[model samples]
Target chain A: MSDAMVLDGARAEGLATVREVPAPGLIALKGDLGAPALADAVRAVTGCAVPGLRRIEAAGAARAGWMAPDELLLVAPREAVPGALSTLEARLAAAHHLAADVSDMRAVFRLEGQGAREVLAKLAPVDLAPGAFEPGELRRTRLAQVPAAFWMEQGGFTLVCFRSVARYAFDLLAGAAAPGGEVGHFA
Target chain B: MLLLTCPHCGIDADETELSPGGEAHLTRHGPGATDEDVEAYLFLRDNPRGVHLERWRHANGCGKWFVAARCTVTLEVFGTYPAQTARPPQHVLDAIEAKRPGATRKLPVMEGAR
Candidate 1:
């Protein structure tokens, strides 16, 4: 298999990657995981303590935890992604946990900068703030009504959604972030 | 855009994840309580105050009903707890069994009913 791949989209610019992916702000990590290994995997990705993955705010990363018993998502920095997954899988395997390559099955995206919060508000109704969502904090919510996993980092937000709805979510975010759009109204 | 601090779901949920459940830790004045007590507990504090503790529901999220501590004085909510944990407190499983004898409904029936 090729190391990288890309899927073309309705918009000519489309998307490109060394690995086949869903869309922007989408990340997926699937494995033959149970709760413990999944927690270790998440810690590997976010570098945060995981005890039942409680709902508490993090110092720097906006994190939202979603687990399907074994499968999980650590939506954070794309830059930290490669190392994150490798480290996570390594940790899980070392502990004798089952894992699989879900990178192709999941899509990841990065949304950040000054207008990042505004962009998020258009899709989610939560008030994104330091107190509400400190860095490292994670939440599983809907993006434009689509179920998604979200994480907040230094100046941006990252998310992973179902592959099928990746395009719909992308279109919604793109439209929301467009100049003179609803998100623009908030700005 | 209010940040409802849920004890179970933690913070960081959109308003859509929760529904306003009115004030927090409120109690009835009881039978034959003073008129002043009733009024104060009933309709006296609708006005926003600083540091108010209110009740909220994690409707679409964890499905756990809990109390939210807010600052009506400041309009800031910083914490939450399970619904039965509010003030008056509901009887526990043991207490219910002892008092109502067969009060516990079957899980499947309750689930379907809800």
Candidate 2:
């Protein structure tokens, strides 16, 4: 099989740096996420605990975040996705849950630097105030008109949107990240 | 744009992240209900000019359904609550009462109904 490609090209020219992470392993897990068996199974596979509502937990390079009351998104290094998914599926076979690999179903991008939050505020409607959305927090919200996910890390923020609209999301981010596109003071 | 706080995720979601679910706290009419009752349940709705209650889903956020009490004309939101409950909570009712005195506490009855 041919090697999979990553959406890595971006044109960020301002304080914001927009670029794709390139082929991170993504797994969608749905079930009683609070259940002991499911939580243990997920921890076993990802080496992290199931995050609380709107929270993300990370161990090494793998991270798990709550998507809904019963759903979660597991992100790991690209090379480790397939193995991690199989291990989760096998471990949670008897549990009332679903574990599926969704690495290619969505594209992940990291938007950081000085005005990352400001650039994102132009599209997403949720409050990006430091106190409201701190580090380790994730939200399933919209970017402009498309459905997407947002999470904060050490230096910047990460955005995950459907692969179908990756271009639109990229362009929007690039435009917002341009020199004159500073949010609330655009010229 | 309207902004609603999702009871599930505690996020103040904008109208873009929310989907309107029509009127809230409607009685369900199933297989055993009378014909008129079923008709009222399905077709009848109270589009009051003030102090209206609505159902809204956080479509892009937590994906949980919630209820909101707001003014139809002024667009002032009283409060939001979880959808698992059959009716609006006491705090919401209190807020409405505080805003508009003598507002009807019960659901509006259909015309020509006993």
Candidate 3:
């Protein structure tokens, strides 16, 4: 199967990809088990071996880790996309813990440049100032009541939503993009 | 601006997730526990400082009932444990064990506990 799926609509075209690296902007790993083990699994997958911060400790320069107890999302380059999930689940399995693959549950996207933040403001309640969210900060919220994951960096903004809500959020976001600004996609 | 640690959902949920049962500890003066105990259970509170454990529903996501640890002072949350679990945290266990009449630990007793 193709590594990525493209979803086209009236206003926006969503590039749905099976990311290996958890996407540069936001990555989430959801589990049905306990938080600590799920968080540990995230650490194992992201290749950042740290200690003490259990279940959901922020890791990496961009602050990728478990945002919710049931899931962990990592923020990394688009190129790291393919192997990210397996590496995470495998490490957790070795520890005698179970980690469910939910990468498909969410759709990843990159919204950057000067116009991206303006587009996000229309949809999110939190301010998206570069200084405000920085790189590592992660937030769980609803984009039109659809569960979403978000992170900010110098490039602009990256967000992920459950596949079920991807199309809806994409239109909302794409519609909100600046008058002349373009929405770009990379998997 | 209070942060509630939901044991079941495993996140620092917004105050919206809780309905503010008002206070924590309660009196149980019935056949062994009374109406004054019942009245006090029905209404009244101490509103103590430090670590407070209270009942909260995961209204948005899980819809499961759970206990939460809340700090009255800083409004910061530590963590949460499942409500029906065989063993709750030692502190919560201690609070229920140390019940004294008219002690006034907190308010909004669990309706189901009656």
Candidate 4:
């Protein structure tokens, strides 16, 4: 994340705040994981149980989002990734799986404030109404033209897109968040 | 806008999020096959007017290929299943037949699948 970031202190002042945030560690677990054994390994690593489809589970600072049927994106601090990978590797040795460290491959941003929901609604196609997209739900969909995923976090959302398109994504978000008429659809 | 569920990820995906793969349930025309078989495999396709089985990839979402049973004229998608199936599942066929009688009548290209 430190190597290729174009937005280090980027932030937008509006009813919604779109600011670049330091990346927590990101790990991708993809495979045919058998129950109990693999589930235990995941819980042991992230402090959160394997989430159901399109859900994000959190325990303390660690989070695990179900990215696909066979994939879970785990989040930990930067220092904890190596240890987590080793633990997962040892437990899943006989199991067919891939545990990869992808902390640096992403550009993460936090969209918060009174206008946060409208900012997201402008960019993403998902329904962001209160009951429709509440806290703890994870959605992997496109942000404008780029592939992105965002999850509800209390009053706001934390979004992630590929590092290669961070600038473009930031521009899109900031532009939508610029001082303007309020959609208030989610408000 | 055609909406299809990704059978693998269990998400309702918009057509913009999906890449349409023309037809589904095609058998290969690999080695040891005659010219007619190869020609049919390479060129022939079922352009049925209704109750069609087609392939779709969830490009922006789960990134998995899925088969969709749909009505070509009405664009009413009956069901979606995984792409790993060599032929449309019985339930999907039944769903199609339920809406359009004799809808499972196979094309020449699909007969070998059964």
lDDT of 4 by residue, B10-107 (tens): 77887877889988877788999999999988998879887788899988887789999898999998899999987777888788778888767754
Best by TM-score: 4
lDDT of 1 by residue, B1-96 (tens): 676655665656667777787765566687799999898778865434333345677654544567654445445444455776634223433333
Docking class of 4: medium
Off by over 4 Å in 3: A1-3, A6-44, A49-64, A74-90, A94-96, A178-187, B1-114
TM-score of predicted structure 2: 0.88
* lDDT for each residue of candidate 4 in A61-105, tens digit (9 for 90 to 100): 999998888888999988999999999999899888999998889
lDDT of each: 0.53, 0.82, 0.51, 0.85
> Any runs in candidate 4 off by more than 4 Å, and if so which?
A4-6, B107-114
Error of 1 at A186 (Å): 7.1
lDDT: worst 10-residue window of model 2 chain A: A1-10
**TM-score of model 3, chain A?**
0.61
